[model samples]
Target: MAYLTLFLTAFAAATLLPAYSEVMLGAMVTQDYSLWWLWFWATAGNTLGSVVNGVIGRQVDRFKEKRWFPVTEEQLEKARNRFNRYGQWSLLLGWMPLGGDALTLIGGVMRVPWLNFVVLVAIGKGVRYGFVLWLVLNTAGVPSESVPSP
Candidate 1:
């Protein structure tokens, strides 16, 4: 149940919706949950959420003519220009806070190969979760071995 909650939180956090999975991860770390399991579930959930965003990005153009379209033509153009300049490598920074979600979405807009998208997103998000786990463990003086790996 704890891991499921972590997975759900991480998934939501990866979307455009506002969520703070790091806070939950840190709190869970303090409680001595299995580090490996936490990292695995969080990474998996976050990556899946980003993939969903990418899928939505692929279909975003269909909604361009809608009265409620969220992105303006100019805004879309700017995003497209920035993404083209960066290329698929920008997916490495998809784990960042501000423009991270946008980066993932743009990858889809630009037709980045799906396998490449998954690999890059998974690597980025996995590293982020690992760092958060390490930070929490050290800050709490909880030896990595003190917690089970599971």
Candidate 2:
């Protein structure tokens, strides 16, 4: 049950939504949930959310005709060029609070290789979850034997 909540929260947070999964992750860690399971579910959820961002980017042209999310073709082209030039570095920083979703979308729009995007996104998100796992494991009063070493 707790794992489900954590997964959903993490997934939503990865999207353009403003929710933060770290809070739930912290709480779960404090509760002594299995660290491995928690990390796996959180990573999976977050990655799926990021994939949604890519899908949206691919379909952005459809939305361009609508005023709801207006993006000029010129602007889109500029964003694509910028992403093409800087995408590798950008992937390294996608775990940051802002622009993560935009970065994923831009990568898709710029036609970055899917495998590379997945690898980079997984690394970024894994690092974030790994950090949170460390914090929770250390602070939750769980015995060291139960927690995986960083």
Candidate 3:
């Protein structure tokens, strides 16, 4: 049940949604949830969310003409060129506040190979979740009752 909630929260946070996975993660760790399970579910959920963003980016070219989204063809071309120049390396910085979502979508609109995108995004997100996990495990100090005898 905890894992399910964690996954959903993490997944939602990964998209443009205004959710925060870190809070869920911290609470779960504090509650003494299995570390491995927490990490796996959070990573999977977040990665899935990012993939959704990529899909949106793939369709951005079509929306370029609609004007509702405000992305122009020139902007798309520029993004495409940037992706071509940077290649998969751009995904490593996908956790950043400004360019993260844009990078994911640009990669999709530029038709970056699917496998490459998944791997790079996964690595980037995994690192982010891993850092959160470390914080929960170390500095937060698990409740005395929750900590099993060594």
Candidate 4:
């Protein structure tokens, strides 16, 4: 159940929603949970959320190249060219704090390859979770064996 909650929190955080999945993971680490499972579920869930962002981006592209569309065709063209040259680099930023979600969505608009998306997202999210776990462990110290009763 805790794993599922962590997965959901991470997933929601990856989306446009304002969430702090890292805090949840950090708190869990202060408890006695298995670090490996927590990191895996968090990374997996966050990457899956970014996948949804990519799909939304693909759908956004279907909008006829109207003046009202958020990005001009020329701009999108430039992005596509850049993505072709950079391949998986931009995706590594997709796990960042503010701009990360937008990066994943743009990756889809630019028609980045799906396999590349998954792999880069996974790597980025894994690194992020690892960092969060490290911070929690370092700051929170080892988990206490028991909580004193009130």
Candidate 5:
């Protein structure tokens, strides 16, 4: 049940939807959820969300000719050039703010290889969750009682 909650939380957070899984994850860890489970579920959920983003982005080029399309031709061109410049390394930033989401979306817009997208996005989100769990576990050994029972 706790893992389910974290899964949904992580999934939604990964989307363009506004969310903050890190806080929820940290709180859960302090509350004594399994570190391994939380990390696995969160990473899985977040990566799935990014895949949604990438799939949505893949369709963008088809609609680009329409004036109603949100992205301008110039903008698309710039994004393509940037992706070309950075290669898959740019995907590592998917865990970051503003730029991170944009990177994910742009990856879709640029039609990044599916495998590359998954591998990189997973790594980025995994690192984020791992760090959060590490911080909780290593922070002077937090008292378990302070964290409410699960």
Candidate 6:
């Protein structure tokens, strides 16, 4: 149940929705949950959520003509231009809070291959979760047992 909650929180956090999985992870670390499991579930859930954003982005063009379309053509073009400049390597920074979600969305808009998208996103999110876990363990002084290899 604890892992489920963390997974869900991490998933939501990776989306456009506002969530703070790091806080949950930090708190859980203090409680001495298995570090490997926490890292795995959080990384997997977050990567999956980013994939959801990518899926939505792929379909965004179909709705561009609608009244409720969220982004303007100019704004989208600008994002596209930036994404093109950076290319797929930008996916490595998808762990950032402010623009990370946008990166994943633009990836889909640019027609990034699914395999590339998943691999890059998973690596980025996995490293982020790993860092969060490390920070929690080191800062909170979690015992050695909680720091086992993942």
**TM-score of each model, in listed order:** 0.92, 0.84, 0.88, 0.83, 0.88, 0.93
Looking at model 6, residue 136 earns an lDDT score of: 76
Q: After superposition, how far is residue 22 of candidate 2 from its true place, in Å?
A: 0.3
Q: Tens digits of per-residue lDDT for model 4 on 79-123?
A: 677666866688998889977887898888776789988999899
Question: Model 6: number of clashes?
Answer: 0
lDDT of 2 by residue, 32-121 (tens): 577788898888789878877877777786687776776787888888777878756687666777888888888777666778877888
Query: Can you list the residue pairs that collide in candidate 6?
Result: none
lDDT of every model, 2 decimals: 0.90, 0.79, 0.81, 0.83, 0.83, 0.89
Task: Kindly report which residue stretches of model 6 are placed more than 4 angstroms away from their true locations once superposed.
Answer: 145-150
The deviation in Å at residue 19 for candidate 2 is 1.5
Give the better candidate number (1 or 3) by TM-score: 1
Model 2 spans with C-alpha error above 4 angstroms: 138-150
**Candidate 6 C-alpha lDDT tens digits along 44-69:** 88999999989988998998888899
**N/CA/C clash count, model 4:** 0
Summed over model 2, clashes come to: 0
- Give me the candidate number with maximum lDDT: 1
Per-model tally of clashing residue pairs? 0, 0, 0, 0, 0, 0
Candidate 4 residue-wise lDDT at 105: 83
Supply the global lDDT for candidate 5: 0.83
Q: Write the per-residue lDDT of candidate 3 for residues 40-139, one digit (tens) a residue.
A: 8988888888888889888876767785877777777888888889787898777666778788878778777789889998899888888998877678
* Angstrom error at residue 74, model 1: 1.7
lDDT of 1 by residue, 1-150 (tens): 999998999999999888899999988885757778989999999999999889988998889789899899889989999999978989989999988999999898888999999999999999999999888777878766667666
Worst 10 residues of 4 by lDDT: 141-150
Pairs of colliding residues, candidate 5:
none
